[model samples]
Target chain A: MSKQAGLPVLEQDEAVCCAPMVREPLGEEAAAELSRMFKALSDPIRLRLLSLIASHEGGEACVCDLIGPFDVSQPTISHHLKVLREAGLVGSERRGTWVYYWVLPEALAKLSALLEIPAVSAKAPA
Target chain B: MSKQAGLPVLEQDEAVCCAPMVREPLGEEAAAELSRMFKALSDPIRLRLLSLIASHEGGEACVCDLIGPFDVSQPTISHHLKVLREAGLVGSERRGTWVYYWVLPEALAKLSALLEIPAVSAKAPA
Candidate 1:
């Protein structure tokens, strides 16, 4: 199947190397890649899950530590974690029966850079 | 009809004041509010549409200027604009027969701030 089948069409290489999102329309390829990442964050449960993991002690959070706060089924929380893991937003490691998650700062930093405005160039004298 | 009918559940007031999305699991109330904003950004077409409108000359763009570059039907573009409008990402003004869109920089700034990392504090190393 074409990669575009389930995704927005884009020129991947062009997307990875382009002006920031504010400066121009994102190329189709770049948009899809970026959109998927955003979509992963489009859900509230997932965003909270990410936050909890990121702020946990030692920069890592255990599933056991996560399940207590939310009333949702444990499986539902796990599903959200899986989505985040696949999006490269979070990393997970299994230790015995528990899984621990930690933020992947670089991935989120890339996403942030897309929206970054360069320090405003020295303003021409008005 | 309840507002939650078509929207994710969230407590609006609490969401507006809270720790960043990365520092804690977004409360269901906060998550819902924040998720809608992110969902508006989850589509590639919408992202490009936002950028195109923001980067246009004088920080405003006309529908006539944007329609030429994409192959999609005008209605499709219009639909995306409506979504962005409702999400408070852009503002539209009618000038004669053409509609112009301008960036709402404060709205986008609010979003960026939600993800911002506070500067690290000065500390003595052990």
Candidate 2:
């Protein structure tokens, strides 16, 4: 009754086994938290501010130092920083004359990790 | 600096050499573009929609397939998909009777790479 035969290919089946490159997608809670972080980065000013702070010497920047790079007013930068801080993407401390802000590595790492999708395989499923 | 003394510590100097862990920050144009992508992912529904598309078999999803999972109306999901498409995070094509969406790996990689903050060194600069 048995002849040589290959395993059935469920190519079009929706419930087929997941390929190696795919994993469980982001859940609602994680998506909510990540979206908050992404929302903070949704503005160019805030994204630049974050990049500047992260790439600056010592990974921290004085509020006084940040103002000169942009055409925006000090109040505007502060508002952007407030958004970043509230989203947990950065931490700040008031020093003598200015507040210093630094990127929160864990937060950045989490966002980075979520966005890092494994490359989809060129080889079809066996 | 003429003496055999250690290199001057420009720790507080704003123009000091870049640390190994840091790179040139994002430029204005890049910031603008990246922010748009981040803005697309700023909503919870959109983020999950993207994840769903990216992780689905063959790395794409039929819009008809996507509408069933969310509590929102088909129009709402369509709206979110439009945002993702406009931001370049996903691409779409129309086939027989439906639009299929797929994540654009390069776009995701760009966002992921930008957010990857190299571990800020615990050691001070030489």
- Best of the candidates, TM-score: 2
Output the lDDT of residue A66, model 2.
87
**lDDT (C-alpha) at residue A118 in model 2:** 61
Q: Residue by residue across B28-72, what tens digits does model 2's lDDT show?
A: 777787789999989999988988887788878899889888899
Query: Please, what are the lDDT tens digits per residue for candidate 1 over residues A1-126?
Result: 455545444343433623456665666777777777778878888888877776676667899988888879999999989999998788889999888898777566556656554444111111
DockQ per candidate, 2 decimals:
0.29, 0.35
Residue B96, model 1: lDDT of 96
Judged by DockQ cut-offs, the docking class of candidate 2 is: acceptable
Top lDDT prediction, candidate number: 2
Candidate 2 similarity to native, TM-score: 0.78
Whole-model lDDT for model 1 versus the true structure? 0.70
TM-score of each: 0.77, 0.78
- lDDT at B87 for candidate 2? 96
Give candidate 1's error at residue B79 in angstroms: 0.9
Residues B1-126 of candidate 1 have per-residue lDDT tens digits of 544454333343343734344554566776777678778888988888888877776777888887776879999999988888888878888999999887666456556655544333111122
Candidate 1's displacement at residue A54, Å, is 1.1
